[model samples]
Target chain A: MTSVQIEVFLQTLIAGLLLGGLYALIGLGMTLIMGVMKIINLAHGELMMVGMYIAYWMFVLFNIDPYLSVFIATPALFFLGIAIQKFLVNPVLKVESILPENQVILTVGIGMVLANLATVFFKSDYRSTPVAYATNAFYLSDFWETSPIELSLSVPWTVSFVFAVVITITLWFFLAKTDTGKSIRATAQDLEAAFLMGVNVKLMRVITFGIGAGLVGAAGCLFLPIYYLFPSLGGQFTLIAFVITILGGLGSTIGAIIGGLVLGVFESMTATYIGMGWAPVGRFVIFVVCLIFLPGGVASLLKRKKFGK
Target chain B: MKKFAPFIILTILAVIPLTGLSTYMLHILILVIMWSAIGMSWNLLGGYCGQVSFGHAAYFGVGAYTAGILYSKLGLSPWWGVPLSIVVVSVFSLVLGFIVLRLRGPFFALATLASGEVMRITTENLVDLTGGAMGILIQKRTWVDKTWYFYIILLIAASTFILVRKLMESKLGYYFVAIREDQDAAESLGINTTLYKTLALCISGVLTGIAGAFYTNYMGYIDPHVAFALHDISIITIMIVMVGGVATYWGPFVGALIMVLLAEVIRSMPGLGTAHQTLFGVLLIVIIIFLPNGIVGDYKKLKRLLGFRRAST
Candidate 1:
């Protein structure tokens, strides 16, 4: 391949890493809920959808910049998450005997409700912030030619990679060094023990769920300029998020980040080498292949190498 | 009880079509039968085995596309094509099940969702084989008329209901319930959970596939969007099952009758296209929250009012 081709390839790889960072941000909810509540929130994507809408409407109505609205929208969603967990999820959590599929059904029902509610309210229209920066791109260098050296390469981030990195790091810090974070970990590891320790297991579940939703809100804030927002858009990223959470391990926060990055990079590579439509095929292949080799998830795979399964 | 129940249902089913009803009512009846049958098929894996697949549309699509291809390309009779489609879809389900059966709970659901997506994408992409997204249309066959199609679907629907009834009474049915309740405990009791789950999926796939063929043949068209969409999974099958009542044979049948009829009726009214879907979504949420037992299950609580013994419990 020519140097111009190499430049384009490198640019795509870098873009994939940046996109993966946001994927990780959005996927934290699925993994966290699974870790603590042992319930996979199928509505996780739907929650993200609502967050996107909230951010979108905030932008449209108040003319607030997409990034700036995160401060308001994230807190609102956080409380919404807490309420849903406390009232809806808590009742189901008490069942001594719950099947995995039952959880899937309940969450699917919740997701359907949220998605259709959005559709009803928003009418399935696509929206994006009309900020001038939404379309800006930066060129790094030109590729060499035999005589003139004329070919060039450019990189684009409507979401801005800096904001994505910042959100990811903030989430990392929140999960690592807070009293609530430790309680969240305790709830995930030993639910009964956490309760026995007077950790208010119920409150912790609501709090963790809230934080998860808040992270997704942050993701939506980051995603508004990068991609168009719609109800159906939830379906697209939700699929990849599922794979990312599973590949990362159900409860591991850091695992979600790594898994998201890996899947995003793999998807970009597949879209580049194979085709755009086959991106899902690439995800499915990786999901199945990973399950075959690393059933506990990629986090376990990593831990196994460092210690042992 | 066994001798009279079938005879009673058969008599009622036969008498309904002959009533002085409008052609529109007949059309609605036919649709109810088909959708109820599809819902029952979904319940086999989802309601019975506790696998909650959101991808029954994949099997449904395969069935429709198979019959459409054979009838259009090879001039084969749908009679043969329909049965052949079921076999093909069952085998496909077996392969998919082998890969995905080990996945627990939401993971399994997500995997099935991905599979449905893959099928949709492939159908849209493989223009030569599946006619792409614009869809392939089939010329109506002269040998079988619309009434014949109606009866065939009705028979299939009744058969599906009876099959589910028989299975629920059998030991295999108990095994399914056991797996759904708790897999490890069931395994401790010597049930082969994997084998039973796979069997449920295979049955579910075959039934759904047959329904697909019947649907395509009835419409004389096949399309990827309608046949293999997540919307179909969520709205048609999952919603009907929940409304009908989980873990019950007749729940889907009753549920589809209500949900579909409501949708059709609402669509007739002006300015309800958008609200129509929201109504169903809100209905689904309300059903889950307030009427967790669903109509069929709730009926048992009114056994004295209905003057019938509570059979569900």
Candidate 2:
């Protein structure tokens, strides 16, 4: 291939990786909730949307940087998640329902309420944070004067990616080293065992959900400067988070990271090669392929390899 | 009286148009029947088989597209799409079933939801055949009156009612309930869990597809958004069964009636139309928590909550 072709491919790859960092943050939240609650939070995207709106208003009203608002939004979303779990989801869990999928359906209702209420209050108009550095990018050719290919990275994208990486590392530290985090993991692994071991499983569930919502809220803040916001945007992102979870393996943090990166690259490649509209179809293709051939997802593959070794 | 209840209800519904209701009322009646048909289909798979699909829109859209394409391309009457959809949706469901039926519970639900979005996106992208986002509009509508549409949907609803009743009564129905209650136990008992699940999916999909085809003929317009709406079509189908009663036969019917009328009442109210989903969501939360079995399924609980007491013996 020509140097120009290589340059374009490299650019796309870089873009995909940057996008994947944020996607990983989103997927991490979903995987955590799925792992601990044992129920798919269909309202996950709406929580993210709530985060985005919080960031948007912060930017619009107080002139706060979208990144800076992440602090505010994450906490707000944490409370919202706790409230939802305690009042709506927890009660349903105790109820004798004909369908085991009732909790999932309840999340759907929550999502609808969130998205619709956003429409009512926000007027459904697409909005974005017009940050000062929105279009600012660093050119690779400027630094490497003798480089064969030119590359440019958007300031917002790079900053967002850095923030995502930092947050992910911190989360890893928390999950790996902290007592509450260990309890959460134990609950996710085996609910009964965790409870028998004297761990407060219910509190862990509530805290895990809060953490998941907080992470996704941070993602929303990161995405605000780069992506358009609307009420119905929650549905699509929720699906994206879900696809990532399934692709990575249900409730596997590391798997979610890998799945997010894979999805990001695949979606960017599809957009570059085919058309923008077909990018979602590409996501579904990968999902179906994963379901059929690799039912256990990347986590299972990693597990099998470790077992073999 | 219990045995004759369905017949009695059908008879009353069949003559509703004879009361010479306004066109708007007839339209609402048609919508209620159509939703019930979709709900019954969903009830079979979700309520009976325990496979709660969040993507019935995929089958529904395919059915509508099947009918729309026939009229648009083959010059056949759109009514032919109903029967043709049974075939098209069955094949589609079988293929989808192969992939999704492997996953149980919530995983299956998400997979089906993805499939619906995929179908919508596919149709939206394939502009030449499906008319893309512009949608297909029938040039010559079969009738301007609402009575015929009402009758047609009523007939479809009745047939779906009968078919579901028969299926649920037979050995197949028992297999479905067994699988729903406990798939592993059912398998241990030598029930072909996968086959029965697929069967449930096919029957459910075909019935929903038939309703979708009817929707196209009734509405005289076919669009990817309208036919494959996640919230409008698929969620409403779930809500019908969920709000009415999950496993009960009468659940979808009563749920459809309440939901359809509730939607109309909400939408017609000044300044409240835009917030209808919020209200629906609240209702859903209340039903899930307080009446998890739905109105019909948890009638005793509801009656007790309402402070109704049985006469002293």
Candidate 3:
């Protein structure tokens, strides 16, 4: 390949990796919720949208940085998640319905309300946080003096990627070392056993939902500086998170991380090789292939390798 | 009395146009019947078979596009789409069922949702075949009057009601309910769960496609967004079944009437137009929590909630 081609490839790879970090964070929230609740939260993307709006308003009204708003939005979403679980989802769980997919449908209703409310309040306008450093980028040529190929990285993208990594590390530590986290994991593994062992499985479900919401909320804040925001944007992200969870294997954090990166790279490649409009199609293609060939997802592969060893 | 109830309702609906209702009211009535047809089809799979699809829009859109393509490309009458859609959507559903039927519960729902989106995206991109996002418009509508359109939809809805009722009373219906109740147990009892599930999907998909074909002809327009709308077509289909009654013959009909009227009322209000989805969402949440089985399925609960008491024993 020509030097220009190489440069383009490298640039795409960098962009994909940066985007993957945030995707992993989004997938992590969904997998966690699915593990504990045993139901897919269709409103997961709308919750993130709510977080983005909070960040957007904070930036517009108070000149607060989007990064700082993460601290504010995450907790807000945590409470919102708790309330939804306690009131809307909890009541439906007790009701006897012909279709056991009632909780999933309820989440869809929640998503519709959230998306519609945003449209009403925000007028369906696309907004973005215009940080002073939004356009600032570091050129590889400037640093290498005589580099063979040119490469540039956007400041906001790198910052978001770094923040995503830091947050993921913190989450890992909390899950591994914390008592409540262990209880949550135990409940996810076996609800009956957890309950029998005196774990508050119900409380764990609620808290897991909250944490899932909060994680996605943080992701929304991180994405704000780099991506444009709109009310209808939630549906696409919800699909993305779902695709990641399926590819990563349901409820597997490591699988989600690997799945996110693979998806990001694949999507970036499709955008580059095919047309921009086909990126979403690429996502579904991966999803269908995963379902057909790798039903257990990346986690199953990991499990198989571990067993083989 | 219960057996005659359907015939009585059909007779009443048939004579409504003769009553000389206003065109606007006729339009609403047509929509209610059309939605009921769609809801009944959904109920066949979701309510009885227990496969809650979040992507009925895939079949709906395909059925619509089948008609649109016939009219625009083949220079044929769009009405032919109504019958042709059964063939097209059956094959489509069979293929779709092969992939998605393996999944149970929420996974199946999401897979179907993805398929619907994929169809929409494909339709939008394939400009030559589908006219892309520009949409297909039947320049000369078959009829400017609402009477014929209303009659056609009513016919479709009535037939759908009969078909669903018949299916539910047959052996296939028993198998569907059995699968819904427990897949493993059904399999152990010698029921081919996949085959039955696919059968349900095919029947449901074909019925929905017919409604979609009718929509294209009645509305004289077809677009990716209008045909394959996730919230509007797919979710509303679910809501119609959920709010009316799941696994009940009259559920979709009642749900359609209520939802159609509610939509009209909400849309008519000037300030509340943008918040219609919020109302729909709230209504769905409330129905799921309180009724669960829907208005018709939980009739006694609904009556009791309204403070109706049984006569003293």
Query: Top model by lDDT, which number?
Result: 3
What TM-score does each model's chain B reach against the true chain B?
0.91, 0.97, 0.98
Per-candidate RMSD vs. true structure? 3.8, 1.8, 1.7
Tell me the docking grade of candidate 3.
Answer: high
> Per-residue lDDT for B31-112 in model 3, tens only?
9999999999999999999999999999999999999999999999999999999999999999999989989999999999
TM-score against truth, every candidate: 0.92, 0.98, 0.98
How does model 2 score on DockQ? 0.93
Give a tens-digit lDDT track for model 1, residues B1-313. Answer: 9668756866786677666667677778778888889889888788778888888888999999888888767878655668898779988999999988988677788888888888888888888888888887877664343466667888898888888878878998999988888889999999999999999999988998999888787777778898898875534688898788776767888898998899898889887866665677667756665455566766654355345445444
What are the per-model numbers of colliding residue pairs?
Answer: 0, 0, 0
Worst 10 residues of 2 chain B by lDDT: B304-313
The digit string of per-residue lDDT tens for model 3 on A219-244 reads 99999999999999999899999999
Tens-place lDDT per residue, model 1, A89-123, is 66654532223354456666667777877877787
Kept native contacts, as fractions per model, are 0.38, 0.93, 0.84
The parts of candidate 2 lying over 4 Å away from their true place are B308-313
Candidate 1 chain A minimal-lDDT segment of 10 residues: A147-156
- Of 1 and 3, the candidate ranking higher by TM-score: 3
Clashing pairs in 1: none
Give the C-alpha lDDT of model 2: 0.94
TM-score: model 1 vs. ground truth: 0.92
